[model samples]
Target: MNFLTKSYLAYSHGEKTVSPWVILKPLGWLGSVIVGTRRAFYDHGVYASEEPPLPVISVGNLTTGGTNKTPFVEFIAEQLSRWGLKPGIVSRGYGGTTSEPVVVLNGRGDRSVVGDEPLLLSSRLTDVPVAVSSDRMADVAALLDHDVDIAVADDAFQHRRMVRDVDIVLVDATCPFGNGTSLPNGILRELPGSLSRAHAVVISKSDQTSPEALRRLKERISHWVPQERIFYSRLADPLWERWDGERFVPVGKNMTAFSLTVFSAIGNPHSFRNTVLKSGAAILHEFEFKDHHHYDANDLQKIEDAARKSGGKAICCTEKDIFNLPRGYVPRVPLYVPRISALVEEPGRFWNVVVQALRPQIVVASNGYGEDAIGARLARKAAQRFPQAEVCAFPLVGSGIPYKKIGVRILPPLSKSPTGGIIKYHLRDLYQEIKAGLFRQISRQLSAWNQLRSSCRTVLCVGDAYLLCHTLWGQGKKALMVATAKTKFISGHWKLESFLYRKGCRKVWTRDEETAVELRQNGVAAVFEGNPIMDLSCD
Candidate 1:
């Protein structure tokens, strides 16, 4: 299911109040094992290709969509061609019917078979070769047979099956990693550190960002992939072209002017809409589709109806969407196409890293605690250590020992608290809102956790009172969940501590003077620790 649907279900059902870690723990391990096995195969050359024909540049992002990868790929292709090199574009042809490499000669051809992106590219750049295939490796091989010099692989950053000479990772200027968690949990495809494999980083849609924001983004990226070069790129609107089936017409403000508005099924629809709005045209109506949504007769009919109702002069759309238009659909409406090109600055540094990687073989080497998780003293220590990291100390974990167990919350913005002060507790009346608040908190925490994992090498998680630490441990992060004697002193919620122990947290730092002795008697590794606040003050 999509993220929104899953979120709605979790919120409506009050599932967030119950610990998801309990259910996700086993499945997470299974996923880890599967991932590990897959990595081993790729590392062992089990999936390696023999005598790969030409250099492949894979452009992709960790999240599902939002990053403008297509335009980035187009930018690279255009650059290569300008440098007097032949470039062939290959895509997975998402939502397309064909599995074989289908060459799209023009936009008039079967969009369903070749997909919108390839068809669009084919129409815009007739000289460039564009092909679509589910199996990229086969497509690349086929391109090689046709004497293609280099292959530009779209959205192939996670496709480790084929070796790429240069990996360009793109991040959306805004919402780089939504809710920062992996799929079903958040939006990440793999873990965050995955960007370390990228030869260069491109912050797409740089126009929307300020200089300071861009710098901060660069710093964050540098923290994870310190060695990789970074560049800023923005989308530029070329001359608006309208296709009337027989010929292409280029028009400016002088021509018979009409307000142009657009909606698209592309990953980042907002960008498409904003581009149209930026153009000196009136936006009468807009309709968005799910990413890679295949258009049907009904969809087209609805769009036509909307256009007719708007009574606006022209219907503008993204080239990607235009490629998906049903046969004879464009003729029905005065279709205006605004061409998008990537305006890249500081290409020298970005391309230099790519060239350097090509010269030699690139070798890539690649949270939680709970209360005992929270106490005034523990909070003081955390504040000292992680002044920037948001601290969330709550009673939701149900750990019997309040002082010893504390939960650290990350990514605070996603959660929303009620506006008014606490009302006399009414469980039934506040049920839905409480449940929604909890889900939002968990969602934000998950996003923050994923973002932290992606950006940091080591994260310290205190308090084993909650199962959140268990969730972190499951994801293969180095996490230390501490539980003190004060934490065990509490009763009903303290039962949750057992869940943390079950999830493989080796060290439980106890606040009790005799914690080591007591844990040894119970066959748990418990070390006695002096007050954490003292350490914080000294540092």
Candidate 2:
């Protein structure tokens, strides 16, 4: 079962359940194993490929959902069609029963076979084609056989085997990277660094993001990919498109202050909520589902009931969710679908770069991997330079476990001062003892630091020191707590210093210029190297 389903079930039972760590521990290990095996298989040429007839444009993201990929794909397909080129869309047909290539919209055949989005396109245009297949490569090949000029892969970022002419990565303006970790550990599909391979970075949901936040995000992305083309786009919500059985009817008016029964099966329901609110619609009720959730008859009944009880004027949903709903569901109520479009502030410069990459002169090769994982990629580079050295990984232990077990439980001192001492004095004494105890515990774990110091030339840390310390202990490294003033410290000052001392790390790196000055004033010899964390690129 998925994380939400398991969590909900546990809560419903009212039983003491395992923590997130307990659950993710096995999953994390499994993910690591899968990644490793996949890499090995690729290296051994287990899954080789053949080239397709035309250029393929993949619209995808590292995270599961929230990126406005569907609308962006539509935009690209429309642009291609306008240029007198036939573009065929190939999707994984997520949540659909069909596994084989199904021509949703042939541009020449009956439109009923096509889904809502495809049908919507078919009704509006007569030159574009849309199809779905679980095997994306096969679908693209089939489209090429039909004499299509170009093929667009919808949400195929993780499918690395199908070589593409251009890769467009979309980042949601909010929560771009979830806790900055892979699935089971966090929300990311691949490591954040994998974005470096993207040809262009499109910031979606820009309307909800502040100018300052957008600037900071850009600055962060600039560190890893200096030459990447970044573009800003927002979802236009004031424009409405309602499906009238066979075609979408555009309603030109600001839908502000209208009562809506908002329901969606998209990854980020909160994003939909904010979008509707921006359009001046009051959300009377919100029905959220798992990503790409296929709505059944019972689900429709629930929505109908909620809409009636709330006295909503209409039932609103995302374009994706509309395809999954029953054919006659919307006719029963005042259902109005909000059509989403990626409004690019600058299109000329963005398309120029995309066209440059699409030029026939640029030869592309399949890497046989979707995108390299950060740890694995780093290990490979490190191995290349030091052929004989062993590569070790120090990953942060999943936070889910600790958070669930502790449940806000603070660590306590092992002993108390004698009864004769003043209460304040006793408290101070207890604090010092506890600090010492923490140091001692850390020191014992790192006793083999000397061995690692002699054998290994360099120690690679997966992330920050708190999690790094555990990995260091696993690899027998003399981990010096690289304390920064910016690091969130929960305990008292004395405790923090003591903990650092026990970890065998006295060298600290300050993130900001002011932090270095503050640390020096406080008698800390912190070097202002700037924040390493900010250097991360989301592509």
TM for candidate 2 is: 0.60
Highest lDDT: which candidate?
1
Per-residue CA lDDT of model 1 for 377-486, tens digit only, reads 44446556755534433322332233333334322233233422122256653564565575655565555444332222223345434343433422333234455324
Each prediction's TM-score against the native? 0.60, 0.60
lDDT of each: 0.60, 0.58
Alpha carbon lDDT at 353, candidate 2: 76
- Kindly list the per-residue Cα lDDT of model 2 for residues 155-179, writing each as its tens digit: 8777755556688888887867765
**TM-score of model number 1:** 0.60
lDDT of 1 at 206: 84
Candidate 2 wrong stretches, greater than 4 Å: 1-22, 36-46, 106-126, 243-247, 362-539
The 10 consecutive residues of candidate 1 with the worst lDDT sum are 360-369
